[model samples]
Target: MRTGGGTGAGAALVYGTGLAQGLALVCFPAASSILTAPTGYDLSPSRYGLMFAPQVVLAITAAALTPVLARRWTLQRVLVAGLVANLLAMVLLVLSQAPAPSGGAYLLLLAATGALGFGFGSCVSALNTFAAALVPGREDRSVLTLNVLLGLGTALAPMLIAVLLPRWWLLPVGVCVGLVLAIAVAWRVRLDPGPAAGPTAGTPKAVLPGRFWWYAAAVVLYGITETLFGNWSSLYLSGQRGLGVATASAALAAFWACVTVGRVIVAVLPARIPATAVYLLLPVLIVGANVAVSGASTAATAVLAYAAAGLACSAMLPLSISFAGREFPRLGATSAGELIAGYQIGYGVAAFGVAPLMAATGLALSGVYLVGAAVAAVLAAVAAVITRSGRRPDPSVPATPPVTTATRSDVPERP
Candidate 1:
């Protein structure tokens, strides 16, 4: 398990990549004003929602491709490629802000977001896998820490946007410059190219294990709840709840800040504190918070409710991936990628599918919070089932042993 001198550098690189991912992700929701402004794209809510569809679709594709790509490339190489994509995405986004021909702006924006999705998906898959591999037995804590950095980036985006937009292009431009610096940092960091030590190492890869599907389903629900609130809360606060633009931005920032803070709390908790307890308890809190958001009459009430919802939902995604990695250590990256794909599917459904439903049914923005609550309730039941089923190890699978000397060649090939 010794990683030599590169462990510290690798860890820093992973966290830095996470910070960049968070900053990039927040741009979409944070830039909602410019994206839908009459002077800008003048996009309808449905159209704005549609813009996310490409990102989701491309992200799912990138995630699915990560494991396949990793077989031929070093994990660091894969990460670098993703970062390059992110830089391209940022540049494209900046360009989309320029005056363009009729309908060209929308097309350019979609292309930019699609690139962003590809970059985020690939980078996240690689970083999560790299972090898990760096600390063999502490996958949960490592993943949580990485995601905490990402949440910090997400939190910063809104505050930056509130101050910078009408000139939102600066956000992406800043991200692009950051990516350039991050890519350089990543190149200098050396990652341990070792096979993950686990009981299932030599076993034949099973075809989509039952437990993985359960985890995937749980993340789907998690994605729906998380993205629905993150993307829509600003609009809800401003348009429906009568908050000013800056106030709505502040609310969004508060929500992401809570998410970052909540993850930090979980990361430091005793390792013996079962993740199942968190999985189960968080959904109940999320359901309550969503209900609160639904009934919120003032900006203050809505901000508190959304922040609470962020706190409740913060650990669900990372924890689900951590659980899967622990259960199937040998397939750590592949399993994580699958779970991410499942998450993106849910995100797409919630982000894009919900908008038209709202348009048709005359559901207020808060009504979507109720829908998220229902999904979260289902996620809770799934978590309970996971808890019960995970009580004992499968007899068919053995516990993974600690890895001895392993090279890049020792890494398992794609199943």
Candidate 2:
């Protein structure tokens, strides 16, 4: 598979993936209203939750399978397939909006979400690899920039829903059409493919370093904390906090907006500021934000707290991935794909595990943000341990030599 490509094409591809992810992420919250409007299917909460299960499961499956698939398909092909899957998902969603047989609508919605998950998982793995390769030594900026596009997509979803719902049930269909056009544009852009998977002395196929697992653990926690807010915050605001539907949606938008804004801030910071310092500070801020969100007596306070949480949580995943890439320089793409899989695992847990707890606890769900905050604390501790230990390498594990373009033809050209 070809790996190098023009920087312009690579950026376009990455940004497209981000927008696809954003649109897919909003499906859950948007569905809450989309499935209940006068012309809609009126799905129950259990049924709505069931629709998400397949998306998360299938997405995890797709992400786990990417490394294997990359062995045969070009990275560009894999990305194109992902975009095609997203297109199919959007078509399914549009069909779901049309009048359908009694139970078929729910099934259509399920298929749409599942396809979306597959698309998202595939694109996420591919794009992160591409981003890491794009800037070479400055992976933090590339990853952050990529995620900022993603955050923009996520932030736009709720705002679109707020503006177009009820009267414009078909607005998402139009959005999907735009996405399909964007995908077509991306398809025409030639780019580098993923690196081949092979065992090398510098990058062993057998044993991974211990610190890799530490990074994975942090990613898992980051997923839990981020998903807790992204997935549940709307329900918490409307159902528990007694905010109006539009207001709650706005708050959700606020959370993602702050996330996007925070990424921009992190991206521009002086490289002299250690990433570890940023990592250490975020968890404390996240914990405090969660505390404020849980105790918030008014909608305004809760919205502000959720936004604060977004800012606090923004840099964790991208920076963690960047750190892992630096630590395992020889296996940058592989390490990224693996850590992302770890992230999806955590996402699956949060989606499946937390919802039931919320249902069982009812009003007590308001306190669930604390659990996320606590997880963030664990993540902070893990980062600290990794930082202290990373100064000295273990004798048992051999240090891998850094990868070079001559060594791997598939590594993309630096922008």
Candidate 3:
């Protein structure tokens, strides 16, 4: 925070955690893709899909559990646990090799999901908590930067792994290196201590006022847009644009690259703008980008559109997380996890349904983008309304006590 507004302690921890997340996501996604390659493991299309579905479910559930884990265990400890889980998963996957036995693949998949869940859940939770404590009033733009940097890390992993693995056996070998790097980075930092709400820090008893759910839903809706592209932009580019698969992948990479850039920009934006205003802008940006993505006939147009989408979607989560955490401090980490889980669920559902719908109706990828745009628009309106109208209720007392010298006595003293 010497240069930025956040404290150095919080910044270091978040940045390191971001690195770890990047490494984990990068390694997991890239390493697993080779599973179904006939020349490699020869898994069936359906089987490959099944193998990965568990990963998503487990990861999403684990992410949602972050708040509970954080309350029970400090953020750093949880992350350490996650790292250990990641190491174990990698070992099992490496050892379970050769012809893919149904038992072995699923075992490895479960282990991997556990590992990912641990790493993702703990780090995301800890970092958000740490950030809230450190950055007092400076949440919005700063979080955007974190999101961008993290996206860059995620996006860069596949390309790097692709380059490393072309020589055959070196692919899985690189995964070990990544896992170690992720662990090392996570080890170097510490989470800023969470709020001193004492017993209610992160509990079912943790109060979630109406305002909290409002922000959570906003994040959920916005998140669907982000995850949709992340999961399928390459396929859309390849199939719809008639670009070679490699070329389409490059487009997807560009999307991530722009996401990072957009996050950086938003992070530096002026504080004069209200959160409501920023939230409202998200839908507008998303619609424009999605339209570009679907309607573009040329590769250049595709890249530009998807990249804009990445950039536009970048700040949506950061803004929502910041708003939710501060607006409902008691539910800070829990809401963060909830919103993230919502996003993942939306992603999973959309991924399964959208592609098939397009295939069946002969609707172009444009149709998919159009639908996503509509969703984004609805989310924007809701966020604006919530930001403008909803007020966080006092969780400490069922009713606001009559103001008097004695009423002040019940207010919890700040740590």
Candidate 4:
């Protein structure tokens, strides 16, 4: 397949997906800090946890099933449908909350949250998966650069929301903006219209074997760290440590600012250092931050800790996903979605659900932090072992064998 020039729009969509995922990932992470039991939002702990729970499961199911679904619908069409649904859900939730939120209001919140989660979830998984497959080289710049874009979104979403919410309450506004972008680009842009766009396997493609499960586990473990810090940062500072909401919000924003920096730094030399080194570095840096948080005698220490930990974890997930995804092109969107599910489950277990049960350790926040460090340690060891002994197959991205008619990618699928 010959191509037309779209270096600009293609780049924007990639950046935009980063924005959408950043917002989707942080949508609840942002609100959970502000909308808790004390805030009188009437959204129970169980309800807040429930908002992410079903969405994670459905995202995994959607990621895997998206290939089949895409056979009939264009990827853009699917994205547009989900975006519209998400916008509706956000508007409904905002209206329900204004005059005084209720139990019924919480239900509406969850339903809308699920729609947005799945839409963002599916679009991200599809685009990233396809990018990995379609790139001309296995370890290509575009595929790797996506980590930077993703980091940009994740880091920016919280800070942007935190900064803007004070003036315009931009949750509704951000969703509206994203809906327009998704609609505009989904029509104007096309991402390599070929078999490279989706999964070709009927069932259980054997190229990756079972090693991808390790990748899934690594992400879930990594997510625990992110959840503990992201969902509970404000609470830890304000509720436990006796800081003002304004001070805590600044700490959280600073953390993401550091994350954006960390990703760009690590991205520069990703191929030089081994994956295991990045894995090992994360927990070590996080433990150092945890020490500061535990002994945050003043506001300055807390802010420093948040920033350091953000940089620590900034690149962990994208690195793991790239390493794990190298062999499993057939899984495509589903694999990405499943890993995200793993991420949410681990995050939910620590932040909203389990941490509350261990009430002794300052709502079990410290204990969860310790547990997350331990999980990261285990993943480093697991990654070391897998690097040495996993199913080794040729991972070369298929060459564009002279395009006569069907295109190089359509040649009976090479693994």
Candidate 5:
């Protein structure tokens, strides 16, 4: 495990882990219909949302502790631990389906989600670090490639559910096998993610730079906007628009498919577009898509609107992490970990708060999309400020890698 670099087998495993993680992360959300249907878990809206509360709490804790744990446990050990947690989560989810809807079943689901939170927190943070190091100078593209795999897994989940229906537990069973494979690979590969951060990175007294807070805030807001679609799109379509379960599932899949395809397009686009430009423009698209989705009537319109929302979400998170990585090169894994924590905060807010807000305000799911549009607008404003700042890479390090065939035009604006 202490003998390999971040290429060849190790890189493939890292990317595969991303796909597996995507599948694991979306399992609960993808089964939202089944979990709440009369024939299924028979949960109320608030209860459905409340299921994620423990996940949020534990995920934040695991993610925020990555840098601290990495100092002693090493990134490899931390990743292995995350994988084991993920496996336990999938196993519990499968067991949860054995009993009919009852307190025992619900408790199993809660325990599974809590484990998933820890797994997602630690696993994703480490993967971001490894992905950034894969291509040396091309951190953004590398991360985008990894996320493409992740988005593909997410897209596949609901489609599988649409096909499998009541047998959705099989999906996590497959993911369990995948996790087992990933854990084996983690054990075999060292996955050196360049160099570790400076000594202060692990110190209890140390803090991230003030400028990093803007990126954190932007991601937190972005997380809320993303979850509004990821967690609620199916419910909105089936319940509000009178679409069938299959149609709603297809719409959700469409959103994730576009997210994958959009990242691919951005990664290989010929134009030397500034990353900041993409970052700022996406939130505007999100705003429009959210408004459109809220008013959609037909299934076609709902699917298309959600697809647009997915495209808007495609590259934003990777870009944010990459940007912060470039600005503060020495922070290494800590930067990604902290940003993940921020995004999970937003995730928690949207996951639990939406139902309560709807109940208190007497607004429908459509109105929630409208509110998400406002949040996207705020995200746009934050992106504008980040772009204007235009922080350059560290002066002590070389501006470009000494390796291969990438020309000046292939790279995005560094900041």
Candidate 6:
């Protein structure tokens, strides 16, 4: 399974982008306090929530177009393009700091989020493809590793924002520098992301098989579940639970830290434990974690609950992308993009969707979390269906020989 120097370099660059993307992606949400503070951006709950509306729209569009763009432009070029967009997002965030919290500042924030959405969509899709193709037989572990780094970035976001409090713009500025370096390296290094390259790039296949909808449905649900925590946990803790801003930020950091830790645990789990089992089990945990968070009153209790939710959410996205790649060999790297689009759809539903419900019904976030538990239940049902059948390995990637040892991943074929 040795890779050439170029492939290894490409893989490093791709994985690094995952971390950078994670940081940039969470910057806005992680600074939720500042955005909504009366003296800060002066954004209301609805306006703050609505900021991501454009992000969801553009992210889905960019993700959906990844395959088409890869076909026409090549995966390396697409990755670089995504990085450029990511840089623009950071730049916009920095510029938004220049204006006072007026319509002008708010509009800039909206634009920044929209750019972030597009960058996230394109960058994550391409990174997933490269991660799988670069590692061949180890696609599952590779994807998990990539996402572990992503989770690490997410974990760092809240803490970093807290540390650099009045200097929030510095975070995005730092991200811009990292992205610039990644783009430079990626632009020069040639990456052959298996079938997405010239060989089958021109091949016209069904845009997506009907079966993809199963993975899509699972991830969309997952998106809703994760966003409930990722986007709103800080606000929920600070506003509803009556915690200090710094304490709430710590709780958010704890949640994402546990996410990274959980992903690491999943990656190293004994091979006998089936991935599908882990996948199915996570949503069920998410269901329970939601209930725990909803009921938590004290800082310690809320932090612990958030940590549990993070662990529950840790591996769903990576597993979804990995399973989709295994199931649709012909689609190659593009399969990740389609799955990402589905996830963004869920993100949209939860991101902008919950705000209106609260504004219209005067419901509290605690109640919203209760509704999330129900969503996670449905997600578990979808996971059951997705994992019911064994994976069909990708033909392009060389399959590892079946291991003889009893491993953590082993499970009965039927539930």
In the order shown, the candidates' Cα RMSDs to the true structure are: 5.1, 4.7, 5.9, 5.6, 3.0, 3.9
- lDDT measured at residue 62 in model 1 versus the true structure, 0 to 100: 88
Model 6, residue 128: what's the lDDT? 85
Among all windows of 10 consecutive residues in model 3, the one with the lowest summed lDDT is 405-414
For 205-269, candidate 2 gives per-residue lDDT tens digits of 43467667998898888888888877777678888778877667767778889999999888888
* Candidate 4 local Cα displacement, residue 83, angstroms: 3.4
| lDDT (10s digit) by residue, model 3, range 298-348 | 877877777788788877776777666544555656766777776667666
- In model 2, the runs with Cα more than 4 Å from the true position are 1-4, 167-171, 182-187, 193-207, 358-363, 391-415
Ranking by lDDT: 5, 6, 1, 2, 3, 4
Model 5 clashing residue pairs (backbone): none
Looking at model 4, report the run of 10 residues with the lowest lDDT sum: 403-412
Model 5: per-residue Cα lDDT over 1-415, one tens digit each: 5555556887888889999998998898888878888888887877877788889998999989888888777777788999999999999999987784988888998999999999999998888888877766677778888888888888887778667876788899999999999998888878877653422335552367777788899999999999998888877988988887777877788889999999987777644676667888999999999999999989899889989999999988888887777666667778888999999999989988888899999989999999999999999999887777745444434654422224123222332
- The sequence of per-residue lDDT tens digits that candidate 6 reaches over residues 25-85 is 8898888878989878889987988888888998999998888888778766778888998
Candidate 4 lDDT over 243-338, as tens digits, reads 888778878887877777777776565455644466557756776666566666478988888888888877777656555554454455545656
**Between candidates 2 and 6, which one is better according to lDDT?**
6
lDDT of 1: 0.76
Q: Model 4: runs farther than 4 Å from truth?
A: 1-6, 28-54, 67-82, 97-99, 133-135, 138-144, 158-167, 193-198, 201-208, 270-276, 356-363, 394-415
Error of 6 at 191 (Å): 1.5
Compared with the true structure, all predictions reach lDDT values of: 0.76, 0.71, 0.63, 0.60, 0.82, 0.81
Error of 2 at 208 (Å): 3.5
**Over 4 Å off in model 3, which ranges?**
1-10, 31-33, 89-107, 167-190, 196-204, 359-362, 390-415
TM-score to native of every candidate shown: 0.88, 0.87, 0.83, 0.79, 0.91, 0.90
Best-fitting candidate, measured by TM-score? 5
Angstrom error at residue 355, model 1 = 2.8
